[model samples]
Target: MITDSENMKQTNANIAEYTVSEISGALKRTVEDRFGYVRVRAELSGVKRVSSGHCYFALKDESSVLDGVMWRGNVSRLSFVPEDGLEVVCSGKLTTYAARSKYQMVVDAMEPAGAGALMALLEERKQKLASEGLFDPSRKVPIPFLPRKIGVVTSPTGAVIRDILHRLSDRFPSNVMVWPVLVQGEGAAEQVSQAIAGFNAMENGRPDLLIVARGGGSIEDLWSFNEEVVVRAVAASQIPLISAVGHETDTTLIDYAADLRAPTPTAAAEKAVPVKVDLEFSLTDLGRRLSVQKTKMLEDRKQAIVALARALPKPKDILGMNSQKLDDLSERLPMALLNSTRQKSILLGRLSGSLSSGKLQQAARFNRERLLSASSRLRPISARLLTEKKDRILVAARMLASLSYQNVLNRGFAMVKNDSGNIVKTHEGLKIGDKGEIVFASGSVAFETSSGMNEATANMPKRTSEKPRPKKPNKVNSKVDTNQGSLF
Candidate 1:
């Protein structure tokens, strides 16, 4: 018989050996091969995003849980942020984490599982945005009665856009700019949000009103309008926005955030512009009313003038008394003129009798004698005034002579002036070699300053070699007496 050790050795040799990593790797391949891809419905739990942009979460129902991982690229594509307790359907391939030695669903796409789940998520999101005041009534702007240009955000090939154009053409033709974007699938939310912002950013041909429209559909098909980016963009629009995303019974988050909401795309167009015929009719009616009012006012004024005219007396009756008074004055005028002429004639005769030639000559003699007597009195006063004027003139002449700078020069003083003809009051400004003049009563002398001369000698006149001449007092006195004699 073979020994026990030998049997154990044979058994061990018969089995294949494997390392820890090899086993783990083999298991990962087997799981992937069996279920390459899957769609799992479960409530989200422990949803966390790390700094590296990778999302980690657990999908659990009542009794079991499965781990899920989404790479950075896929995480960025998510329409809504993942949160705990949100029910979602994840579409991904099966994979394994070697480090943890656990299997996980490598999520490429995720969405709310059903209409109920989506509605719940939408309600939660609506509450959150509402709390932040994004849906406040005060935040909404008034829609324009008629927009100059209308910017539309919708699919170019859809019926929604055609309906909007048709309605606008019938109501009021306007400039319409279509920003075509995907309405339903993968990147639809991003495109819709960007379209809203793009219209606001236009510098030229910018729309005064915006209409975000899409045809009616299920919640999943219209979920792009409910995205947070799209909703926030609608709220923050500078131009007024009208959301017409679905049929009358359907609603979306954009309806709450938009400046105004219309049940259908055609309704949005109607709200944007008024009917052309109706506006023309209104203008015509207003014009008619204004004309009627103007005519009525003129007629009332004419009637008032007539009433006032009747209250006054007749023109002929008002002038009758004045006319009679004028007639009476006319009758008395000729006789009064005759009586005045007669009285004037008598007075003239009396005056002429008194005024004879002798009386006239006597009056002339009297006036002549008076004139001679006045002339005799005026001659003495005239002579006295002439004597006083001469005396005053003599005194003024003496004072002027005393005050003259020539008199100061005569007392042995001299004045200095700079080259510029300005009086030199002090020697401080006189530099050596500077040219100037010195003035005395007799004459002036030009000279340059020298270092050898002191300040005291600068203003003094040079001495002459001849004897000094004396002043003639008798000649001045004789001149004064001659002036006095001439005045007399």
Candidate 2:
């Protein structure tokens, strides 16, 4: 009975043994149910945000250490980061990581351990970020006079966004993109920073400017804008940013880093754009001034042109001066001609008194007969010289005909040329496929050059197959043969 009892106990213990996953799941459910909303006040350590945007850290005191995680979705609800050594109170469900066989707290909310601690932390961060030049006035971007689109980073359901939209509509209506983010809580700073960066990194149709705004709140309620992440994001933004957190008295770190700061969300909208009515009035005034100035300039130009026209000489006056000079010249022209004719008559009379008319006639007859006899003798001499020159020209013509290329072509010989028009003196430069022309005694033949002397002989059967002979005059007519009809 003792052995059976021990075996039964051992079997019962074995029956209660659980698998790794089962035990993990059971522990997770028990711990979660027991402390579903427990708040842990401890110093944070080993805080790290992963690439996936999930935050993993440890909450520890002197006696205990608890591993904690804030999911990417729930992280946006946090207003401050849990840095190492930072005193914080975190609230969440206790859960287990089944694969690692470990348990951790899934933190959904957090706050600084006390108001004093949060203020001290905020001051320390402000100094650190300032030391890095994040708060330099030189780093601030200039707000555009007119932006096509404006981006708003705020809570979607709050009065802040509605007020900003209404103000923008009243002032200058613009395309407003609302990047909804938690205005306060544990990880709200990260969301705001991410929203800022996302708008900056946009490639297609990004907002021209950004506004980080929120409604009236206490220092704790506005702590998200004071975060290092939020401050750095504002400083590093490519587009100009405006900070409008709470009322005029609620100043945040973002207000310092932004290009412009507003007392309220509505003021931020006003600062972002101009009042439509005021702009219309200014435009109307400018247009009227421009029209008046243009009219004055045109009138001044017209008066100056009239002054210049009056100073210029008249066309009729110029014509009258030219016509009076023409008349004076015409009156002097006849007297000048008469004076010249009288001087010539006096010279003719003096010459007439010096000559004998009968002697001049007799000398003229004698010279005419003598000139007739000499001309008759010179005519026959010129005809005889002409006959001799004709004979000499005939002899030179025959000599030139014998030396010409046409006479050579009349023989059995020929001129061969390549496609480039160079005389083919030898077979040295000939390629097998080279085109060439062969001018024969009768006509010309075009053919491709041969690869070798043997190929040339085989290609031109009648040229090389016949017995070779000394070239003699052929019966074919050439261009030099006038009586012979053209044969070549």
Candidate 3:
């Protein structure tokens, strides 16, 4: 509301109701109240960034523009990615950047104009790619330990390229082929995949190793690396592959499908090549050991040959051994013959002694038979003669006794009898009897009379201390005590 009523200097006092500071303060308050940490829809423009990591940008379209700042903390949340030509809607607080003396909005979030719908589309694409078996582990290639040639798939101008090159050169100086491709914008995945396929098709023995790498960025900025097409290409690679993308914490399907994964481009290069200096040192050590072993073996063989030459025998020595054997046989021959003759003589003597023993045995057998015959004859003759002699002697003795009995009786011609009429055969059986009978060699007689008592009984000798009186002293007269076979 400008009026040309007074000169610019004269109208100043009339318009002194509001100061520039007060208006600015009022506007600041109004903007804060209206748009405090809110979400707004606008196109991106005038995007400028300061060294402090604070982004200054304009949210504009054909109709209007709003100034904005994204501090470091909030700047990380952007999705559609703020660029000069890109259109996005921001979510932030409308406030003043006091240090710059500027009115702006501090953006906390941003996205493409229709990100809500685009998310659905992206999810569908993800599913479609996933169903095609592009993420299968079976298709992944193996990474070679020592690669002579390496193929890099990344932006040609990014820090990733420099980092990987430096690492490869440090690890092993060798030829590396760069397969540069767009790593970020639309169709970035297709271009990257094509580049991989192209490098493979070139085949040139297919480069020993393939490195897919990129510098660190937000997930959206690095989405091309996570695409299914890129993953499938990596898996299908004939050569071994290494994936290096973003920070150590960032992961993608390409990382899973590749033969190896590294946290950074430099690490990926380091994994692909072996250190040259270390390998050379190892080779030198092995060669020295091999040479030493060969020399020792040659020395051992030479010593063996010398010992064999020293041990070899001469022809004259062999002839001397044969001559010694011949003389030994000659000295033993006469003693062997003498031993044979003595053995034969001993055998003949043993045969003669055996014949003499047989004749002596025959003579001993004849003598034994004669002795048995003599014993048989003496046994029968002696038994018969003894029986005849005993019988004759008994008969002669009986006749003689008959003739001598009368002679004896006549010499004693008297008989004695006792009181009981029994004969007094001997003086030992004599007793006084009333009757007596006497027999001589030719006659017998009986008498009754008294017999005399023995004088010893009359004396009583000590019988019971009394005289055993004879019974009236029966006196019987008897002939002399002479009997046929009795003697008094």
Candidate 4:
């Protein structure tokens, strides 16, 4: 036998040496070459998307797990959002990451494994959106009875749009605006959602109603309508929406969110508008009925008026009866008046016979005696009233004499008056050469104010006698002439 060290040296010499990177590269090449393109059926787990726009997840079953990565380009092409616990088939080539020294799948394409898986995913999504009230019946709006303009979202090149146009033409020609969009496959959901938003954002020529439709296909072909963005857009649309996405047996998330659902594209067109001919016929019929009813009502009123006129009494007969009664009263009126006058005359004659001249004289004498007696009694009262009146007059005369300004003149005072007959209370009103009157209690004398007559001389008392004797003129200038006669 060889020694242990010698054996190890010989084995090392035969084997090639490699660094960590070299071994990793060799493993990567081997994996890529062995399974160049593989299809994997597994359940998704730990699905995550980083800010780099790459999706990283793990594909696992009962036995083992495989790491998976999809670049941004591939991720954008997916029809639905990948979530954990979804069963999917991934198609890609096997590769090894040099840095981690591990094998993984670089997924280029992915889809739900079968119809069962798709149905399960759809049910799960429906439950989630329903819980958020996106599918609430109360949130849905009523479709317009007659839309003036209709907006359609579908593939422009497909039979769905052609069928809608043809059906709408047959029923009622409307303003139909077709928003062409991909209705299936990659990016179809985004296009469909954007078409809905675009219609809503229009300021002019905005449609009164919207119809999202697609031809019947497998679940995968119709999966775009089930996208959350498309479903939410349909639910939040202000314009009433009709979902005609698939056949009668096929349903989508959009069906629950839309205001109405049609079995097919043709059915949606029928619901959008009513037949023009039918509307015209209805209006004509209603107008005819109204006219007939109006005529009947007028006839009934005319008949009622005629019946009322027939039941009334004739005007000539009513007037004739009143005229006869008036004539009877006129014939009896004169006779009645003559009898009354005769009775009054008899009564007057009897009254005159009873009142004889002697009796009348007696009554007059008696009345005369009564008057003389009353006069005798009233003499003292009349004398007393006269005497009292004379006393009041005398007393009033005395009080008047006392309160008179003449009394002031009689008390050795004189009143001076201007030429205008106004009293001059102050000497300041007197000017030299101004003519005025000096009034005494007995008489008034005219005087002229001279420059030499001071206020002291003006204040002097004047002659108040009934007849004043003439005095010699003063040598000094005097305001008054001593020879002036009394004016009273």
lDDT (C-alpha, whole model) for all candidates: 0.82, 0.79, 0.70, 0.84
Clashing pairs in 1: none
| Model 3, span 381-488: residue lDDT tens | 655654554454455446545444456678877666565555576555744444556666666655444435465335433448676555443344444434343322
* Candidate with better lDDT, 1 vs 4: 4
Clashes of 2: 6
Instruction: Estimate, for each residue in 248-294, the C-alpha lDDT of model 4 and write its tens digit.
Output: 99999999999999999989999898998999999999999999999
Ranking by TM-score: 4, 1, 2, 3
lDDT of 1 by residue, 1-488 (tens): 99999999999999999999999999999999999989999999999989898999999999999999999998767656677998999999998898998889999999888778889888999999999899999999888887899999999999999999999999999999999999886568889899999999999889999999999988877878988889999998999999999899999999999999999999999999999999999999999999999999999999999899667664445544644554465455456556755665565555556778776456545545655665566557655754655565465556555555678799989898878998888656677667776776666666666654454344444568876555322101111222233110
TM for candidate 2 is 0.52
TM-score versus the correct structure, for each prediction: 0.60, 0.52, 0.40, 0.61
Q: What's the true lDDT of residue 389 in model 2?
A: 51
Give the per-residue lDDT of model 2 (tens digit) for 288-375.
9999999999999999998996676644454445445555655665565567556655654554556466654555455456556655
How well does candidate 3 match the true structure, expressed as C-alpha RMSD?
45.1
Candidate 4: clashing residue pairs, number = 0
Segments of candidate 2 deviating more than 4 angstroms: 1-45, 48-78, 88-110, 301-334, 337-488
Best by lDDT: 4
Those runs of model 4 whose alpha carbons end farther than 4 Å from true positions after fitting are: 1-15, 48-54, 71-79, 311-488
Which ten residues in a row are the worst by lDDT in model 4? 472-481
Model 3 residue 471 distance off true place after TM-score fit, in angstroms: 99
